[model samples]
Target: MAAIEPEATGFEPESAVRKMSGFSLKPAERRALLTILCALLAVRILAMFWYPFVDSTEARYAEIARKMLETGDWITPQFDYGVPFWGKPPLHTWMSALGMKIFGVSHFGARFLFLIASLGLLAVCYVWVRKLRGHDLALVAIAVMASAGLFYGASAFVVTDMAMVLGTTMSMAGFYACLADKSSHRVWGYLFFAGLAVGLLAKGPVAVVLTGIPIFLWVVIGNRWRQLLRLPWITGTLLTGLIALPWYLLAEAKTPGFLNYFIIGEHYKRFLETGWQGDLYGSAHARAKGMIWVYGFIAFLPWVLFAPALATRGRQVLEIFRKDRTGWHSYLLAWTLSPLILFTPAANILPAYVLPGIPAAAILLVSVWAGIFGQPGRKTRAWVAVSMIGVAVVVFGLTTVAFFFPNTLNVRSERELVQKALETSPDIAINYWGDRSYSAEFYTQGRLRYIADSATLEALKSNDVRDALAVYSHDIPRLKDRLEAGFVDLGRFNRRHLFVEPPLQ
Candidate 1:
């Protein structure tokens, strides 16, 4: 990891705080680094196009967006038609649905907006790091962040967390820019609240909590309380409300009990209660308290592997937090640690929750790397670049493997199964015996339904449409003798057995 010593120097013109940094990269070296970063990004985009949306999480959201698109109800994202989904706001779904409108509802269409959002967050962080350090350091930061475990995995995956990450990044970047600028700070000040609005819309109140943590800690620890007044508070709150409040209000009006379920049940009970049973749409993801820190370690990988780079310059790293007037280093530390700290006590968490902190962690790591290995020679710099490139290549390789052998990776998508079922019963309404698959809904365009009982199955059949049953091998015995005797089994697709109406003897 140390072979390619990263090049960086602190550039805090607002307070003139500088870090002890390493040698600058030559033009050829910089170009090489840039080329690698761009290539890796292209690979990430290709992964998005090549891979199918896996079952449950990715396909669930994609199905919800597809439903939203079909229903023309822009106000609420439905878990199923007539069932309003209050788990999250419509920001990610809105964009994904818009992407589907323009591109058609395919893997690329459903996932394209997420890639745009992830790259947009990277862009914001890249510019912020460039202002604090130079081109080389910024390059190191984005390279580390973009290839990190959770960030890379979620780059184009259809999840709500990416939009929230973008919100947190924008807020963190705009806040620091406001601190750094010598004049004309009003625009940046408004940007801080604009980020708040985005975050609120993207996830919920948690976005505000994520952004506020670092700012509060930096202000209190640095005793820089007077800086708060410089920002435009009165108008900013109004702007945030204008953008985010209407949706909350409108959702509650459209569907009663939405606000109560979403705000209190989702944000409050779900966080503090393990195995929280209040979830209306899906089961809660519960982990042990403080598990978020462990997830943080996993999510920040490849960069987390380089902790010794920062530890080697422990004194300089500590001194920046204690002595730097611009609050940049301390701010980065606070920003990177904020999500981990906040979710440490929460019983429900996922690895993607760690994403908001990763960009700051990468920037901070590269800054310390530069501080420790001052003027690392050309050979050492090349080694550092190779180390980073190797990690990224490994990530791309994993994606390639997933593209080729999804089943090997335990990737669950009902696309092929649905397609195979259609060939067997072209006009038959395919139904599951029990339990629904979101990927089936997405692949079949919301036509897939589950048989709650014999009555529903008979009712589907009475519509003069032959209703085929796709039952799991294990679940085949659960059906009545009529179904088991009256149907022709049409072979297995994955674990499920598709059955069509019996042939006349």
Candidate 2:
């Protein structure tokens, strides 16, 4: 693939940037850009290693992986010891479990694979864009994508979205290769299905929908329906089924009703119905319809600077489909907009649902820049500095506050409490006196117990078995009222105080 005409993308081709599109960055600017990218990645890696997994999302997933490893139930992820978590598929859990198995189950172990997944996406962006538009603009695209709030966070954050988005990107890339070049299409065709398998396993059928919409729109609008035949559809569908169906079958067998809940409740009702209450694992996050558009802007805030230009630019990206020179414009535009379009009418949406479109958004933003400005210069460096460096500074500030101030952000991690409890005496099991702490469950290697009643608490106290209780801050007075004196306060974490009974004299 040669350099795509900057005009062939999202905006008018008559701009000064079209002339500068061929220009490579000066060595100094190139080094600076590379340095900034490396530094941003380094910061995220540090945060991944340093930060504790918080409750309700990160720790929830981490503990599930820990339980999966402990129980050896690879087919179904558990919300509790035996209860199945039907909320999502098992790909992200498998990755984290594998990481924990290989690296030892800490934050880094659970989260390491996501970092790899994100970097792999970045590499794909760089190579694909480099092939289409040369080196300079590719770097610009990478910077733009890497800095987007959603992408930056998802780079190492433990969520199913990154893997699902990676699959979408793979589908886009592999589909483009199959459609655009007939000379070498076999492997790329398979890669397209492989992405489908990944997306299906990582999230669910939504992966196919997210990738399919752009593909269908692009193929239909271009009248390149025949080009899709170039793909190995019969075999591709088989491959996807081969990879994804086993888990679905196994999960439903292990916990019947998974298909009905996941396929119908999650995929359909969760999105269409406002304030949907059918969710089993978590509450529905129902926002106003079309808030996804707002989330799209916020997610891509760094490069959303060109949003005004997009008013005209979107039409131009579509205009190129008719010429069908390479189908690149059609591919980019459809892939980028598909998520927003899919979620536009859904009342239940999360900002994370906006993730699938970030890569294509990054690509189009840089294309818009090249089509409009035509070359990297002082403004480019300043923009990267503000975008990249400014984000770094905020991360640093948050890290400092998290470590020093400790309670300002009210981080919901029980790692510190677990560590202190073991230090007090690693021999006894600890109980959470208030809400369940998944982080505690994870940090304790499933040794955490919940105090179900006062009789259970008194029995342990009377038995001469020195016990530990991680009492939530709000429950401290109640705990004191239940068991007065004869306890040592070990210390406190965000919301919990670890109190251990003193040995009987």
Candidate 3:
């Protein structure tokens, strides 16, 4: 081949240059960006449709949102029966309720809002990394987050995790902006708004504890303690109270013991007790070191390989701060590590509980990538290319297994019983083995009516039902033994021995 022209090698030809320098994108580059964004969106959409609503938590949240929409109740979020749901705040419910109103109570509809939130997260990551690192490294961070399994799973569900992620990301971004503009009251105002929004959306006051405390400590310890009092505290507090008060007031009125149960009992007591924990993993304080390792492995999938370099670069950045007496890197490090330490005392922990750390981790990884590969060098380019290819391969394999694998992999026979119920009585009320009804409702599209033996049964006894489905478990044996006369077993659906009512003769 002929030798490359100097203009062609170093820069575009003068005549071919159509726009401003530095930020101007060529046609091919624009197309590539659009393609990548579209592909990510398509993956999220497809995954939302493909995954069966897993029961218990995810399904329950969706059902509660659906009911909230149907009943036009925004104050108290309920599921199955009108039992108190003290697990999470109501922002996710609000989002899902909106989805139900718009899309009319489908899995895709309930989860669509989360998909949008995930997209917002992805966009935030891109902007954040671009600000700290360069465009190339930002792209790498985006790719890593897009391909992570936990990220994908949460993005495709109607859960608080996505909202938490969005709020936390916003908080982190605002923190960074506030640091950059300490003299500007407007920046502080924005930071306060973001913190308030996140606090209301997440596990209440803990949001401020998790985010603000670390940031404050970082600033104070770094000799910038004077800056703390400069924030627009009065205005910010009023704004936050305004956003958060209505729900608390309404919930307190509707549920007599809501404050005692929610704030003190559920939030505080759950953090202290291990036995009452509802997490798939045990309590936070009781978590083994291995659990944290596993969380790192899963949450940073396809990107975990780069973690070593990321950590090394993060340390170097911290070293620079130590020498210069600036606390920027220290703030990030504290934000990342504080929650890990704080939540360790809680009775329950989840991979998503540590999700707030994701942006900080992404920034670290992007910085590392930039430091190693920002220059035009053969070895750097080769490493970057190899890493990209490896990540793409792993992501493709995992998504293939996750999406195409049989239901037998993740779901149990209880789910199959729900599936059978869907086929037979698509609209009949179902009495569950307690809070376990969502497993059925998720699969059945909120079509099954729930009857808890103690409360709902008394209310639903008047309804006409020649046959009813009772979920059998050790606790609900009475439902199996005390059946109405002329009841015929339709067929055993699964190992749990679910039976359907036959048509009245």
* lDDT per residue (tens digit) for residues 173-251 in model 2: 8877665554557777887999999999999999999998998887677676656677898999899899889999988
Q: Write the per-residue lDDT of candidate 3 for residues 1-505, one digit (tens) a residue.
A: 1221222322223333221112233355445545655665665676566555555568778877877887777888875446656566788998888987898767678888888887887787676545444455556567656655566557767778778777767676665554444345456456656656766665676776677766766666665655555456677677777877878888888877767766776567666676665432223345553365467567766566766765667666555546433343566667766567667656556677767666666665554454443442455434645554554455455555544553435443245566566577666545554445565665555556555555444444444664455554454356544444323455443324454556444
Q: Looking at model 3, how many pairs of residues clash?
A: 7
Global lDDT of each model? 0.79, 0.81, 0.60
The total number of steric clashes, by the backbone 3 Å criterion, in model 2 comes to 2
Q: Where is model 3 more than 4 Å wrong at Cα? A: 1-37, 132-136, 182-188, 277-290, 310-326, 376-406, 412-419, 425-435, 443-498
Task: List where candidate 1 sits over 4 angstroms from the true fold.
Answer: 1-23, 320-323, 375-404, 454-466, 479-484, 502-505
Give the poorly placed runs of model 2, Cα more than 4 Å off.
Answer: 1-23, 306-325, 490-492
Report the C-alpha displacement of residue 292, candidate 3, in angstroms: 3.9
- For each candidate, what TM-score against the reference? 0.90, 0.90, 0.77
Cα error, candidate 3, residue 414 (Å): 6.3
